[model samples]
Target chain A: MVKRGAASCLLALALPAGAAEFNAALMVAPEVDTPNTASPYYVGPPLVPDRASRQDLELRLREGGFNVQETLRWQTIRDRTPEQHGIANQFYYDGELGDGLGWTAGKKLMSWGVGFGFKPLDVVQRENRRLVNRPALVGAPVLAVERFTADEAWTVAWTHPGRGEGSDDFRDASLALRWYRLSAGGDDLHAVARLSHRRGLEAGVGATRVIGEEWSIYGAALYERRTRRLMNMLVGNGGTLAAADPMSEQVGGGGTKAVAGAQWTGASGWSTLAEAWYDADAYSRAQWQRLDALTASQHALAGIAPAAAIAGNVAWSSQAYLTPNLLRENLLLRLGYDDRDGFRPYAELLATPRDGGRVWTIGAAFEGNRQRLALGLRQAGGADGSAYARAPIRRAAWAEWRLALF
Target chain B: MSRRLAALALAVALPASAAENVAALLKQADAFRLPAESVRVETQVELYKNGALDKERLYTVYVKPGRRSLVLMKSPSEIGQKVLMLADQFWLLMPESQRPLRITASQKLLGEASTGDIASMTWSEDYDGVVEDEVDCPVPPPNLPEATAPPKPRRCLHLDLAQARSGVTYARIELYLEKSIKLPIKADLYVGSGKRAKEAWYVPKPIEGQQRIMAMLLLDDIQPNRRTVVHYRSIVPKAAPDEFFNPAALVRNSLSGW
Candidate 1:
């Protein structure tokens, strides 16, 4: 059924009239994973996989105002069954409702903010920017009306309509409004607001200003009525182990997210970026310490309780590793160079200052006329007993080869 | 005594008259590149390394009266990319993220920084200078591609120009124009450090019974082996809507057929 539906969509995309563009890509990505054993949360053969690889074929077609993007993915993991699925990344139609007014319907990517590593004003699409082997973005279902002038634009969208809330914030039904204006001095100013039952009301403002010939700076801040995060119910209750997972999503009071960054690019092809951001949804230093103590107590019950139960509890506690940021405050620095021959290389370091946790990544990509190759490697480290230091995955490396078939 | 009196009169009025002449000359020269007040230019760029074809790209450029330009990348690899230029300010929007990013001045360098630089260039608005001398037009070096070179030799006016505004791509330009028609012939581009960066040649062809710049050849002085040939496939006098140039509108997939 998946293959049939995808093929039908591809045919539908090609049948459009008036200057249609059809492009297809064939890509193969193989990844190697190195799990850390010294950490208390490592799960070896049964639950967690040792390695994984994916092969993908993506098609994108655009005609007049209609656009469709669909990808077919097949994956293999060590000691696990192969998985296959079809993903519709973006499918939307944009048309003019009247003079200077526009309307867009269907699923589309609507990302807004002013940060590199983190974006505070992305109320409709809370994208995690640092994911390894980032997949194509799956747009939110929205019906948006927008208007633009020479220097100003405003958009009001009903996102995920009729679907109240799902697993995360991206699937929540909400009304989002974004107002953007280009200041007289060339500064970009933006204001965004989102209203939803899951999180009540959220609002933010952002600005980007270019300095001299080689520098640019930007900052943004968002206020939320509620922030939701998973917490261990028995962290301070002094429980050795539990028969079931104790982690559950809990809603907290109002919180704030902010990011500030500056970048400089030189004529010599070298560029540097320095950015820092605070995420109110992530765990704090004190909260990590308490979780660590709970995990230690669980390990002490290895002989008293069933080993499987103890292992499961520890794995449940490892959920902390899944958050976008390990701690609230993060600082990121990146240095990159474009050789001007379609090759670009960069090195980046992301550090959580409060807990001294760090992540180091290096990557390079070369793009030819119709082919692209990318390779990257990342490692986690920091002060002993820090959240990143005790993470399950210690290092990862991957490579991708993509060819455009038109 | 009459000749001496004429020379004295010339010396007293030269400064103000020269400024006006330079402005007029620049406007005349600009008409060759931009044939209309608002135009849509279909351009193709060919990159050559050591006289061998290395890569090719296609761009659709929309230019307006107020130094505003929007470039759409048409190559397969860069299908959804766009660059918006509003005078000294520039923004680049990549297809993957669909977010507009403010770009620094250095990132506006033609060919290397962004294609929008070369796609939209007008000297009358960005530079002010004085005509220095009249001399024979320089011939295109044999290494340049043929269709883009001037066909015959003629007297030329040598102009020395300095940047009149900040955030411009080049700080200085030594321009040479055909003395008779004031048509631009060659330009020596310079960087902020007084280093000659690239040499550019303008190629004019008859379009609609009038001579217009149909092609451009850019020879890199810094990288001796690199050369870029730009061909304007079509230039139509059509003005896009003002709202399309807004930076925030870059993400909308609605610019097609505009």
Candidate 2:
């Protein structure tokens, strides 16, 4: 049903774009993963795909005040049936009421925030940064009114309209406001506020200031009234394993998220960035240790308990790895170089210091004429007992090629 | 004794008088590129390697007062990308991210063609220099990538310029302008390290009975075999709204119509 609706919407994109700008591109991406059999919670067939081949046709159109951006995709994972999907990346309209005031209505890819590794004031989009070979983003539904000036701008938006709490962050309805000011000395300042049922009141401020010609410093912090995370009921409990599912959602009181970073670039086309971020929603060291204890105890009951039940519980625990970050505190260091001739290469290291877990990745992209190619490789490991050391996916590599059709 | 006093006074006045003349000359030289304070310039850049065309890209630049410029990428591969420069501050909006990102001076130098070279057309606002010498206009070499006209003997003004403000693409430039008309002809571009980086030559054409710069040729010193030619397709007076230059406004696509 979703595919049918998306296909119908995509058909409209091909309709006469007379006097309107039109562009399309085709992309083919393939990813390979190496699963760790030594992982205590590794799940085979149903839980993971060892390899995937994906192809997409991306189209874009702009006419007057309306624009459409969408991608049609087909992918096959391992031996599974090939899946077909489509996404409306951005379908929006902009109108002016005069007097420097404007309104936007539709699905829009909008983000009012700062920071490289993480954006604290991204209340509407709430994107997870630093994913390898990620697809184009789909915008959130928004109805917004904006006021603008030469150096300042204000926006009030109702995002994910008509949806209520209990939905995911992207789908939850919320009222958010973003205020931006360009300081006299050329610094960028941002403040944001959001009122949502799920997270309650959320507010944050961010700033980016350039020092000299090569160095830039930025930081942002957010305060949330409430935060929730899904955790296993077996954690902190004496039960070795439950016949039924033990996963439950836990809500906590006030929480905070913040990030600080600096970047430096040299005239030689070499750049480096160092960033540190804290996300309270991620599991803490204590939480990971407790979960680890439970997993160990469950393995001890393998003979006593039903083999399927034990395997099921362990598999459920692996979901912990689904989150972007495994620990509360993360530090990242990256170095990149652009040859100024369309080739860029970079390598980065992410460390979860509290648990001594680390992940490293290296990537490069070369763009020529109407063609672009990118390749990347990632690995996760650190201390022997760290969460990353026990991750099911030990290594992954991906490559993608894109060509503009017109 | 009266003759000695007269000579001393002339020397003192000559330096100060020459300083003012250079400022006026620079302003006049700027006019060859900009007919008005705010205008839209359609530009196409072609990169050549060893005299062979390598790549091409198109851009539309809206130049407003107060050292602000908004450049839109009009090519197929880079469509929907924009760079907004407000004085020393800059922001980039890419279609994939859909976010207004604050970019440093070095970040603006990324890509094959620097955004600064594409958008920035006037140099009087960013430079203050002195008239150094009067010399013959340097003719293009026969081995140049573009076709050259017959050489003609013409006097030119040699001006040595230094950056008056940060964020400008080049730190210092030794420029040569047609002495009689103050039309820019050629320049030696230098980086912050005081090292020669690129050499530029300007080509002027008749526009509505007035001579205006229509193309610029760049020869890179670092990459000896590479040359870039920037062609100005059109220039029309257009006063884009001030709101369009705001950093937060970089994400808005409605400006495509403007």
Candidate 3:
């Protein structure tokens, strides 16, 4: 049904207007990387592919105050492969309604916040899995209305979760409003408020200010009143057996997350950005230590007792202890140099200060007449019991080539 | 016979008449340029490296003087991309991102064209000019092709310019304007070290129905074999709403109809 609708829309757009524009690209990217050599306690997959391929077809159409975009991808890793499609990368109709009012409706990609590596106020589509090497963002459905002047704007939007295989519930929809202003000194200031049926209320403020000619500082902070599912481990039979359950808890008092950063660009096209992020909901140092101890106990039990019951308990415990974004404080630094001859060299370092773990990547991209090539190396480093030390893939080297087709 | 007094007297007396003449000349020259209040222009840029075509880009520019300007990219790879300049601040709005990202003036848009170069159109406001001297056109080089030959001994006015304020791209410039039309013919940009860094030539062409003239600017890096040519495809006298200069409005304007 979705495909049929898309085809009909494309036909209508292509046929009706003489001003319609069409664009398309075909990209085939293949990569080879080293195997993972981390501890067994790591939750993610241990062995990534030594070879993988991804081919993507992207198409866009614009006509009669409407725009539509689509992407189809086929990827293979070793012997396993999957086909994925995004019907509406961005399908929106926009027009002015006189009196400084404008409206846009359809599926679109939206990004909020001012951090290079992390954004706290970007709640919509926040759960989408992102790759560090490739930073494409998925789009969401929305209907937005805005009134704007040369330096100020007020906007309201109704947002819906992106189309995919997910549980459909009230939580998948939300209403958001934003007010933005530009100061005489060229500072961009914005305030956002969102209400979700399942998550209650969330509000945030963000600002970006240019300092002098070479420096800029930006930051975003959000406070949310929502319920979180926390893990609870129960010990029974005088501490000899254990079971894990998820407990729902309401967190409303000052549960905030913030990201602040600054950037500097030199006259020679060298730029650097440094950012720091704090997630109040993330695991603290003591909590991480406790989880680490529990994992170690499970590992010891699995090694010592090979019985079926013991193995099952260890597996369950391992699953229970797996957490996402476990660290509280993180710092990111990015540096890049573009010589404008199609050669760009860049590097990024992400450090979890609380756990003393870090992930560092260095890459270079070269653009040819009709193709692009990128080479990169990534490494995770930390002491024992740290997040990076337990990372599934500790080191990797990759190369990607993209040939443009139009 | 006090040297300081004499120097001060000369400095005060020399600029009164020269300044008046320069002001008149700059005002006349401004008439040949785009309207400073509000205007829309379509621009195409072609980059050449070592005399080979490197890249091409098209853009639609909307400007409101003393307020803000927006440059929207109209090309294959970056169709709905825009850059908004509010006062001294610059922001890049990509189609995939909801919020505009603050950027530096040094960032390149296409080839040697920086975002600063495309956003700014008024030169008389940023620079103060003094009439240097009058000179005849230089003789054509021996190896120059007939088609590339210099114009025959046309009267020209040479002017030296200095920055009226800080943060401009060039610290000093030497400009030559055709005396007849007050059209800029050539400009040599100098860096802080007083060394010529780039040379630009403005070639004027008439619009079909309009009295205004549009110019094609060719910029050459002082280092040999690097050049960028910017063609003013169209410059229409249209007044954009003040609301259009805002970053949010600029982003919204990039969708659909534009």
Candidate 4:
């Protein structure tokens, strides 16, 4: 169906248009991955793989003179320990039809507008890169808004993932339309209202005001009634089900949760992100209580004497599971230097305290016009056993080489 | 006594005639007042590094004045594939990536003498200061006085041209005005910020219904690091619809092939 739809659209457009121009770029990347432990799947965090190897081939094309873009990625993983192989596939497509109407369907990062609800991507060497290796494909419907403004954009169709597989399978789905208008005091007001379905029924509303050229603030709130299966996926342990068994038992509760947060960014390339949310376990309504979590992140580019920068982020989350009191704390520090000659060097560190355990990671990345190299060492150990360690004491090293392709 | 009186009168009239001629030439150069309607120009640029040709550029330009100009590159597409010129703005449309970029007024060095150190250049503004006698020109040409060597192919006017009226004027220029036309054929560009460190060549073409002339080549090839050159291949004075200059026209009227 996907192939036929794309082919027919091209054929129809090619049939008798009086000489319109079209161009495209084809990018292919082959990647390798290694994971720790028996599970070949690695989502968030890094340096957990005991020994695994995976190669990925991805192709990205921007056709129709850059108005249409499509990407397809196929990856296969071979777990040395489990002696098993798994495949991860992804596809993304975004099309702009001139006057604002557009479409986006794909596996992509789900950042709810202002890097709050979900931020799975990071910028590296002036390019947006993945923070988490695992990706979810959530097909999105796009609606254009503020057509003539510089900041005009289209809101993605869905927020939460839905059920099933392929592009349409999302755990949460959302449809939103955003428009910017003038406020009473001449400030710009951007607002969005989205009907998003997570496991159950979820909806959200958000607005932002540009106080001045240097400052802008935004806030959003979400109300959700999640499905039992979705809750089970989040809280349930890894297990296999009996084949052809319809009455198989699944774990986790189903209930509603409300979330809210605000963010502020400045023109000096300084951005401070802070968000606090309370999740009300709708599945376990009998034990319903408010759980609070907050995250603070700061990023700034400095051109001072060293011509480097200092960026840090700290996050804390209250216990979400009832069986055990688990408080999550995370800290990340990044320092880097850049110059016009195309030489850039950076160091990164991440420390996370989960339950009653601690994990720390330190790494450095260097890049230049002709070469790119990265090395990192990670150690995670604690009294309750290592959160990512084989036994509570874990250490690992990794390095990579990049080849430029025409 | 009659002979002495004749000599005195001759001396007086000679300076007066020379001064008038200088004034007329200045006026002719200043005739580049209103913008042209449409112009087509072919240019050849030779890049010189330490007195040697390193690279070259050959391109054609189409200009609808106050509206837009399109540069169709003929050679070295790797250099500048296609360039679009508009009033007060110009964009370089690359064939490889095919992206349009907004450039500042300094890029005018690569186009018709619209704006530059020569923006205010005219017949009147440049030929001021001391008016010399016909003998001052190199031998054998109206503007070429007989002071320099004939073996040399070109001649120049070395004059101290400080603006007595305003501070925005250039000081001390060694000008090479074409012998036939009393206009600056080429000039040594300078500033208080820098020396007479850059050389520019002006290829001239006679414009219809206009005095003085139009620029055919505005090449700034002396500075190797800042390789800025403009070639005005053909220029025709013709009017255009004002709407053609609007941003709406940018997307409405796509590039020729596109």
Best by DockQ: 2
Q: Which digits, one per residue and each the tens of the lDDT, describe model 4 over residues B91-194?
A: 34433222233332333333222233322333244334443223333333232121123455553332223343222223344454434445455555554344
Q: Write the per-residue lDDT of candidate 3 for residues B1-258, one digit (tens) a residue.
A: 364355344435554433246657776666666854677889887767876778777788887776367888776655667887765567788765656777765552323466556556666766885666566643333432221434466766777788775556677878777766666667787765577766766655566543443544444455457666777787766677777777766556443343
lDDT of 3 at B89: 65
| lDDT of every model, 2 decimals | 0.84, 0.86, 0.65, 0.34
> Which residue pairs show backbone clashes in model 3?
none
Please give the RMSD to the true structure for each candidate, in Å: 3.5, 3.3, 4.6, 15.2
Residue-level lDDT of model 2, residues B63-156, one tens digit each, is 9988999999998889989999888778899888888888888899888998988888988899977676667888886777563743678877
- Tell me the TM-score of chain B in each candidate: 0.89, 0.91, 0.79, 0.49
Candidate 4 chain A: 10-residue stretch with minimal lDDT: A120-129
Q: Could you tell which candidate, 2 or 3, scores higher by DockQ?
A: 2
Report the backbone clash tally of model 4. Answer: 44
DockQ of 1: 0.57
Clashing pairs in 2: none
Number of the top-ranking candidate, with lDDT as the measure: 2
TM-score of each: 0.94, 0.96, 0.86, 0.40
Cα deviation of A80, candidate 1, in Å: 2.4
Order the numbered candidates by TM-score, best leading. 2, 1, 3, 4
